[model samples]
Target: MNSQHAQHSPEILVFDSSDALASAAAQRLAAAIVSAQSDRGVARIALTGGSTGIAALRALRTVGDPIDWGRVEIFWGDDRFLPAGHEDRNDAQADEALLSHVPVDAARVFRMPCDEGEFAGDATAGARAYEETLRSLTPDGKIPELDVHLLGMGPDGHINSLFPGKATLSERERAVVAEFDSPKPPPQRITLTFPVVNAARHVWFLVAGADKAPAVAKAVGRASPADYPAAGAQGRDGTTWFLDKNAAELLR
Candidate 1:
């Protein structure tokens, strides 16, 4: 199960319960983002969508802290290619959970525009537009070496919109691409390709529950990238995996 890509394996942290772990991770993530902004003047982060990710967001809100929300630029790792207000939109979930609760400058919050009446229903155009935005803001021609990229793992080892054995998993050139035929459903999505995701400075995965244990073992045990898409996710600078007892039960 050895993988060269795992050179970025993160410091693993395990907790007793999902709620406690997600909450703590969220608070730490908020603090980390704030600290990065203080040290570097700006911090760009990629966020995920799911119950676990939402729990982490809720933890951020419950924990008392005054972050320089204005200096933080938020991005999504992937999104459902639905209308902005759609329940399945990652943007919508994030806004409800944390974004709307903060005072971040509206201009700094980069959400893909799904409402545009472009052919192919605007997903491709949105992805390309987001790539352009990244180009305009990043110091180099590369995608922003994001301060942090937060993610959640599906029971089957999926992350963002990239599912195991899917053709989208092989994409490299596009920072983001429109995903179709997803194994999870609501097939159409837009996601940050591996090249873009692996470009980040730090990537943290938050996971919980026994249902996700097998995939967790796969991810942590050096499973092949094709069968376990989570194995393909790596942070250029560092990577970390946060797990609860149930999810980490199989890890020897």
Candidate 2:
């Protein structure tokens, strides 16, 4: 880990199992959103999609819906460039898991442009449009400071759509970028860069399963972001790793 990152090491919370982790994350997320809304009148959160991520969203449903959904602005960390309503799309999974159960204002939900929209299959155009949408939310024309940015890490240590050693890792200016050749399928994707992710007041990584143990160890050990994108996701106010015992087992 570099000196800068070492100075703000992530807070680690380990659970007995993935189910326990998801339930805890869901409760914490609800509280965080309510707290943000209390402090600022509105809360913005970026969601992630994956087994653990979606499970957390689903678990949120059992929490009695304490959040004022209408006052919460939702965004995504990254999503495949598929047509709208595609089951594989992150937003669609999110809708099925949580959004549909809540009373969130439709206008406040900012889903990344789909492949069939105005951009129409052009990944770059879609990315640019999403970036514009993010900038439009801020008075300074910068990416909005999200209250919380939730992430799920791949076994290879990737975060969002940013795979290890990918050229997109070098991106510093653009808040969102198109991943034309993702190592994982769906091939094309749109993802928020490190700048936008780190701008969040809180970056919470929800990881589980024994398969993710090694990557969790490396990220917590402070590996270079180019090698482990999760290492690059440091929130301005706080960074946390919520892990299942299987995932935290390998952590030092």
Candidate 3:
């Protein structure tokens, strides 16, 4: 890897293989969770949906060291407004791919409610409720101050439910928002707004594949937030982008 690749990668580490990347990320995130417990006696983390994010969760299951399951709270960065068992629901995916294998408390796992009749209303309610949950968990009303936020970037530069050219891109106050007309499939979704996403003590973006080359290039190369939503996504204390060879190919 060259200087630019080194610069744009995650703060603590990066990997080439999907499994290796996942394992490393999970271990680091777990370590962060443990550290949070040592420092403040509690840890709160936000998780994203998609293959990469799922893989990270899967990695957590096999981690050698034990995590303080009771002290940690898991929340989603975004979710598809589908029924509980729907294939596209982030909540379902997380449960199948990760939550099922962990020791996390059932009550502490905050998932968006999409089974209700009203999609928009459900999304709005879910966002507000998650915000309130975070408020109760945090010593203060602010977000991102918790331990860590694990994210996965789409090929088009979307992160969480915040897509390019969408109104959620500019959200400032609310921790979460209901997004509509997303270009990606399953258009209707709810996501943590930029304010919440960026408020974390640590933010990590796991991006891979040739399909993501263009977005990765624009994100770190041009540093234009609007053109590349990932560029705008940052952690309160720090932000890192993890990529494989193919994704980093266009960084020049």
TM-scores for all predictions: 0.92, 0.96, 0.89
State which candidate has the highest lDDT: 2
* Distance from true location, Cα of 143 in model 1, Å: 1.0
Candidate 3 least-lDDT 10 residues: 1-10
lDDT, candidate 1, 1-252, per-residue tens:
111354844678899988988888888887888778888998888889988888898788877666788998999998888776788888899899988898889999988767546634767787788788888885776677788889899999998888898888888777878776777768778888788777777889999999999999998877987888888887777888889999899988
Best by TM-score: 2
Candidate 3 residue pairs in clash (backbone atoms < 3 Å): 144-199, 144-200
* lDDT of candidate 2 over 1-252, digit per residue (tens): 121333487899999989999999999999999999999999999999999999999999888547999999999999999999999999999999999998999999999999995888798999999999988987988788899999999999999999999999888889899998988899999999888888788999999999999999999987999999998888878999999999999876
lDDT values, one for every candidate: 0.82, 0.92, 0.75
User: Sorted on TM-score, highest at the top, how do the candidates line up?
Assistant: 2, 1, 3
Better of 2 and 3 by lDDT: 2
lDDT (10s digit) by residue, model 3, range 198-227: 667778888778898899878776465666
TM-score of 3: 0.89
The better-scoring model by TM-score among 2 and 3 is 2
- For model 1, what is the error of residue 109's alpha carbon versus the real structure, in angstroms, after optimal superposition? 0.8
Against the true structure, candidate 3 has what lDDT?
0.75
